[model samples]
Target: MLDGQASDLRVFALGTDRAGGMATAAQILGGAGTGPGEFQRPTALSVGRDGLVGVFESTGRVHLFGRSREGELEHRTTFQFRMDIEDGCILGHHLVVTGLHSEHSGVVHLFSTAGEWVRSFGRFYDTDNPWVSETIERSLVTCLEGSDEILVAPLFLPEARKYDVLGNLLWWTEFDGLRPIYLAETADGMVGVGTPEDGYHGTIGVTGDVDGGIAILQVGFITRERRESGSDPEISTYVLAADTGEGALLGRDFGRIRDIDGKGAVLSRGVPFPTLRVITWPPSVRQP
Candidate 1:
């Protein structure tokens, strides 16, 4: 996960145990700087073929890292773009970036590890108003495992689109009344779903995620009312069924789901220096 401290910004690899727990690995990558090997406020992380690591910053710069002969990650090069990057993933020799751009043609930007722009595609929501378009178009992107397909999930919308590495559209699926806050690639090459916030539209009235599926950890509208009355919203967790998209009560108070795999999920739970938790999925919730 990307730690956004202005003083000690760095990326640490997370390792999981057999009991479904996680912690930072010994190897630390990147540092705070504007130089070739350092980055500031990194927003996304992607690992591609050939031991390539791309650290994307909020300022539209991607810092590339590769393993040295001694098997340690070393900064290789850096590249820049004019748009604000939201999220990205690495596929083979290319880096796929998604963010807000002046051009509304597509939200996805394809680039080489050498920092060359290859192409851009995938439609973004546009209402003719720049501010609204930008806010609504924010999305999280992930490259599928064992394939060249990438999945894009809008932050405030309940839909996902699949695309090939060449920027060709494959399939688009929409979930009624469910906005995706995150997306992950399964070990079997399928897409795993996550949660969302109704803070923008206030339709779903919730936020956060955990485990194998989407989870609603708080009620927004009710929470807003309670806060007005000087009370905290009662925290609870609601898990969405993978097969039917139906939600059931889980437990309480977890952070946003960063990624999910065959073992389980990684959750980001604090501010500035967030703590990540990995929890194994219950057998019933694990998608086959």
Candidate 2:
């Protein structure tokens, strides 16, 4: 059971059957009775007790939806923020960008639940790529705890930082770079960072033009670099905390972290690891 964000009550859920059909389900909670309307190719989705917040490239705007009438999801234009200028993650409360990694003047904008611009921490607009002008077309994903709290971790950066929904910098730490991979948070709050190859050991660096190897891990922040034991060599993964970078030594080896969510869960895998294929937590579930 995953979380859904509809409109400030309890956790909402959007489920799919074995036949690959999508539908909204129910959870007996001290909140609302229904969910928002159907969504398409949703990337970052969260459930708040009061409303739903997510990113759908089709709409090209971070949506704030709620129940309109008779258990129907209505689109409420609380905020129409866009961040594709520098492709990055935009979820309920977090916005992760690789502007620092790319150094091409990108943007990773974040907004409060009440629709307020908090903090802006990205490279200024500049021409880095000869092929492209001032645009970041590779956003990873955004993770959030509530409305004002967000974890802005890029795809292949060694460090993961946290910030308030208003964009207030919370904390930052160091890590190896892992590119050409993807990142996902677990139901229990652990981030499941993974890549195709095992490399994020500070051995390789992930640039947009270079075709670097990938890895994944389930780790958290620490004082210094450490390694995990009994990890699968097929894929390197890290389980990091949401911005604090406080965790354990998780890996058999190290590799470069990346911003591209390769052919993995963030892309396409048979089934979700650890837990049943939970899409993401909806912001509405956390709302009240």
lDDT of 1 by residue, 159-258 (tens): 5566788887766655443323444555665545444343222122222222233423232223345445654334334445432335555654454555
Q: Candidate 2: where is the Cα deviation over 4 Å?
A: 1-42, 78-106, 112-119, 123-143, 177-235, 249-268, 271-288
RMSD of 1: 9.8
**Residue 266 local lDDT, model 2:** 21
Q: Which stretches of candidate 1 lie over 4 Å from their true place?
A: 6-25, 102-104, 126-129, 178-254, 271-273, 279-288
Q: Which candidate is the best by lDDT?
A: 1
Whole-model lDDT, candidate 1?
0.61
